[model samples]
Target chain A: MTIEEESGYRGKAEEFLQVFKKGAEFTQDLLRENERLRYRVLELENSLNSATAGSGPDSQSQALIQRISELEQEKKAILDRIQQIEDENQDFANRYVEIEAENNNLANLYIASYQLHSTLDFKEVLQIIMEIVINLIGAEEFALMLLDEKSGDLQAVACEGLDRDEVPPVKLGSGLIGQTLQSGESYFTDDLESYQRDILNPMVCVPLKIKDHVIGVLSIYKLLLQKDQFAQVDYELFTLLAGHAATAIFGARLYSDSERRLSTIQGFLDLLTK
Target chain B: MADYNILIVEDSPTMRQLISFALKRIRGVRIVEASDGVDGLKKISAEKFDMIFTDINMPVMDGLKLISLVRDEPNHKGVPIVVITTEGAQEDRQRALALGANDYITKPIQPNKILDVAKQLLKLA
Candidate 1:
């Protein structure tokens, strides 16, 4: 009820209003700062999620890199196996070519021997056999000595690359070739000086047989000799050639005897008509 | 009980000799040889043979012709004719059986095999 007391109450009321307004402004500022902080936190969480997603791709890439490395190793191993197979194939091809060449040479030799065997003339057959031996075996000198059935002496019937008077007849049991004839087998001499002085170089001798009987001997002398020159294969080939030559010789003898008998019969008929 | 006569018709002397040699080994069997089909037919006409062993390939006359001729004859009808030859084709076997041949045997001939065939066809076993 006093004016002074009323004025004091109004001032207190005004001061209270001013304090409430300041408090509300402070609360609004605090709320704005809290919203900004919340936004920043959300941004950080998004960044973390993005980084985690990027790491997943990196792990997958690492796995792919490991698989690539394994594949490269496998590829390298396959390449090595292919290289080995190619090398083996090349080696086999080389061996096959060498064998084919040798087979061709043997076929040629056999064909030549067969051609020599078809002759029915004794001298011509002997000449063909000597020529075939010289050509096939690469021999410089060759001689065919026939054994006389009654006397058991070997006489040289054909000769190639030798002096006309140099060849000499010998007994069936005398020299190396003669001994081969007597034994009805083959003999090879790599060192000629060990056996006799007459043999000049390496030589091979094969006995000619007709139904288990020794008929003659075929001797071939090598002028150009090498190590492992005379093998069992060579002896077998020479023996077969000698056998064919003996058959030819026998056939030639039969043909000549038949011709002689026909001529003698014709002559007797002419004498009877006269 | 009775001596059975076998007539062999073949072109080859060696084959004829071989067949005759086999037939001689059988008891109560007598074998007569002929070099060709013509000679075989002549021998068949002259004698009454119990059986016939013939070859397909011959010089003068073939075995089929001889078989037909023997079949036409009244006395030689129903006589057991056995063809022993080197022909092994199915057509040859069928044709031979169709031509009144009792049996067919192929060569190179074994003596025991021939004897077995002969015994079976003649009802001797």
Candidate 2:
């Protein structure tokens, strides 16, 4: 559910909690009064025996017994209502906790999405992609590699928590990352061969596709200590970023290219003017 | 070509490199770099610059304060200032322009566009 929808349910749950809490409090108060009445019943019964043995019971004593029985019935009903409301409140509290967790995840997704498109600057896009991987995905070691379209090679553009010198360029149809990108498939570490898994351990390589053509790869190397394994939500995020991130990075590359040409022309124009 | 001294104020090394590299494509332009607004303010006070390019959301101080502070200086009035900011930050862009920033561009900065504005502001070709 969306955050807005969850918040609406949360409001109703809070109101429900308050009403049940009030009902429980009211029932407790009645229980205290009922206990006091039961003690008073003992006194009335003692007096009734005396009056009955003396050949006439006061109407007030008989009336007191009837009132005690009525209060007993009311107390039983109140106790049942309190128990039912308490159970419902407990269930509501659990559901609210679940919604809270979902809301937090959704918020994380929103922030990541916002940051991904925050800039079109080539260098800035690289930084943002790194931040999104580290902060949002909880990956300590990750690499952002761009596909050299002309050479059909995967070259590491940016990396974190790993050695840059160790990142060898991969040809289009090579092992792991390259193979997945060539086939337009996502590769998870669980399906990796033992020898092929030495590098990018426990990694997920998502292809950056624009117009269904894979342009780059976002490879997550090592996960954070807190995260044992990737979750369903991580897969969803991977799917989201594959297209959006690739498109942005491609645009940045094109922008930078135009920028270089413009600078040359502008410089030439300025020299002529001078 | 007019020899111009430009100050690039940004937090990222890569962004600084990109801007500096682009500026170098033109002739007779000297570029100085500062990491954030506080450093930018210090440099602005220390030396004369033909133009200033700054970014928002930095540690210590921010671009908005830097622009206002630079505008408040006696000898720095009417100098051209360009703001490099995030794409979705229109409110900030408008605010910077209102605060006497001469022009603004969203990132990724098209280098030629910056050169164009620089030429107009400095009355070059």
Candidate 2 regions exceeding 4 Å error are A1-77, A191-197, A200-202, A231-233, A267-274, B1-125
Q: Which clashing pairs does model 2 show?
A: A120-B107, A120-B108, A121-B108
Candidate 2 lDDT by residue in tens digits, A185-240: 88887642232334533368899898679998887776654556666657777886
What tens-digit string does per-residue lDDT give for candidate 1 at A1-274?
8999999999999999999999999999999999999999999999999888777777989999999999999999999999999999999999997775455345434554565565677777776676456434445566777887677787778876676356676676677776787788777775753543254222677777787787788776643232225444355457667677778788887888998999999999999999
TM per candidate comes to: 0.51, 0.49
Best by TM-score: 1
Candidate topping DockQ = 2
C-alpha lDDT of residue B105 in model 2: 67
Root-mean-square deviation per candidate:
21.7, 31.3
The residue-by-residue lDDT of candidate 1 on B1-125, one tens digit each, is 44888999977544565566557657889888987889999999898988998887678898888888889888889999998654334566576778899997765344456777778877887
Per-chain TM-score of chain B, candidate 2? 0.92
